[model samples]
Target chain A: MSQLKLNTEGMKPIYVQIAEWLETEILSASIKSDEKIYSQYQLAEMFNINPATAAKGLNILADEKILYKKRGLGMFVSPKAKESIQEKRKNQILKNLVLELVTEAGRLGVDENELISMIKTSNKFVGGRDHERN
Target chain B: MNVIESRGLTKTYGNLKAVNNLSFDIEENKVTGLIGRNGAGKTTLLKLIAGFLHKTSGEIEVFSDNPFNSIKVSSNMIFIDDKMSFPASLHLVDILEAAGNFYDNWDAGLANGLIDYFNLNPRQPHSSLSKGMKSAFNMIIGLSARCPLTIYDEPTTGMDVAVRKDFYRALLKDYLQNPRTIIISSHLLNEVEHVLEDILLLREGQKCMHMPVEELKELAICLKGKAGIIQELATGKEIYHKENIGKDSAYVVVKNDFTEDRLQNVKLSGVEITPVATDELCVFLTSRNKGGIDDVFDRN
Candidate 1:
């Protein structure tokens, strides 16, 4: 029952937003394994999208094995969806952050080693014990 | 995925065939532009897809199912026309309330925000709003409803350039936040050309061309220069449209290879060569008394 809101002012497609929202819900374990998620029609009516558009988002999840259809019933959250979703989301975020850092470094004439040093210095200044060193 | 599939889709109004055996597939997660002249049957085809009109003969599939009277299918699709008429006496807020009830995904916050952005007073009667305001109201519903497949027919008809640009900007912004299959039917081709992933060109109710924007760009080029030089360089080539202004002549459209070396040669020959805009290309393609299709293909 995650309240997935759409920003008509943004440039992303509604389907992608819906997919991201569903992924977030799955990762948070808000939608449990084998839970009967809303059907494409229901989702469409709920979101004011054409059912086909909603189906596209659902299909993306289904393709990733995060959701599965029960045939004549409805789509359900996959048993391993939460774990898979978490792994996928984490990898995606890291990749995006790395890309951003690389791009910024290119712009600012800074190297990866400098970035790594900055991270270490910042961690030290936070005054947290180095658990990695132990 | 093929959200909409049509085969030999034809529509006739007495002697005029608005859509003549049209066939095209609207894919998922892409913005498809429906472009045509005033009587080009763009609206007819859209209405046909929306199940508001029955086709004379042919097949149309929405989500692997016929869209006509299919509650599940139709419920997912929303069609916002240019002339969105609410009751004459109904207040703007009342109309929005009705819209919310009609659309399950209607975002009241988004609607209210849009109303404020447009400076529309909710207490104003629907009949009292200007043409531009009415269009804005319809646009708000189309965007805020978040419908998966939303078809907008001439959404910016009477608006000023500034307002039209605002609508496009808002549309792009909304699109980034929520991706859906949006079909925008408009005569203002130059305005919406960039926003479209693909374009459907209709002429006399027939699909004249259905292709990606990049492909279409590659297919046509504009050549301009001194009349004599341009004519010499364009010899034996298919000219889509040509205009001569005194000593300087410009062909707004032509079919040419447009390769770097070839284009350089044309330029060196004192002819200016550039790619034709989608709008200019459409006008050129649909112009009556133009050469045959083979003539267009022979330019290579």
Candidate 2:
């Protein structure tokens, strides 16, 4: 959707960035379940990246069972894509992010209870809103 | 399979070896970047593949046949660069029409569309266009030809940044519809890095690194942190670049893939990890007197 702005300067690999970008779109329901996803060719055109590199991104999602191929019809989001994506991100990314926050909080003398309370209170303000800005 | 392959290929001029004993393959349907510093024999290699230059020794093959003045190879390939010449009497459209006679895969509609997109005037003489306009026109021809093997050696020589972006966007768009083997040799690595499937690094005419851009990114990453900690952490890693940032702080480019498991406490403490863009990587790898990048790769 041209919403994904890649950070070429960052340490993150490009394929991983592409996968994460598509994942965010999937999680937001902007790209729905059972819907045909962008082919590697389309992704290559859209992002000005190599088609092979784009295919690798698609492959990453396929490996995670987030996207599945349909023979000649191209890749489609799995029916349980959103759930799997949500669960995976929560366990993998969000957990790591929260852990980092807690580590920083601990370093700053903000104890466990204070950090937990802060998160709980902050959740209310950010409730019903996607944390990632489109 | 490789669309183009060379084994111990050597091209010399007088006493100087323009291209040393080089060996590499150009994989089919992939956009490969052929990059090197000045006088690194990039143009010579392209010419050899194009049948414009004869190799002094070793083997070179295109589509399993020698490309030296072969009609089969010439018909299937398109080569464009800054030095590309056109008949002074021919108009832009006239030249394209003539090109159509040669390249069977030529798409006239695509050429016309590119003409419109690049704002190239068909009525104008090819020689009359400015430096940037000529490059754009050349790019249009290269993209529209849709040959099995297309080589553009510094195609964006005089084109501006916006024009270069347009060229890449157009190339990718067209390439999606019709897959082909494309070799783009450019000094502007930052612009072409993402679009390239693989990179072929050449130094003093020898094949250096022929790696996927993604893997190369992982292999060579810059680490910024305190000098002491940076040095301690860089014990066994291949250091690409090391520089003093300030009085006690330094930045080092280590050939670490920056895997998740590789990220340790020292990283969270101070060391800021960043990716080395293809441009910097090329400079570091090709810069003389610091030992070659190929030599430093202990893993390979």
* Candidate closest to the true structure, highest lDDT: 2
Q: lDDT tens digits, residues B105-217, model 2? A: 88999999889978889999999999999999999899888999999999999999999988987887788789899999987788888888899998888877998988888
Q: How many backbone clashes does candidate 2 have?
A: 0
Docking class of 2: medium
Docking band of candidate 1: incorrect
lDDT of 1 by residue, B1-300 (tens): 989999999989999998999889999878888998889899999999888888899998877887788886677788887677789989999998988898878889989998998899999998998888888888888988888788899999777798887787677657756888899999888777655668899998888899875466567777777777777766777777777766667564667655656765565555666666667788778866665465678898
lDDT of 1 by residue, A17-130 (tens): 778878887777778899988776566555544455677679889999899988889899989988887798778767666665666676689887998898789878665556
Each model's interface RMSD (Å)? 11.9, 1.6
Best by TM-score: 2
Supply the DockQ value of model 2: 0.74
Report how far residue B70 has shifted in candidate 1, in Å: 2.0
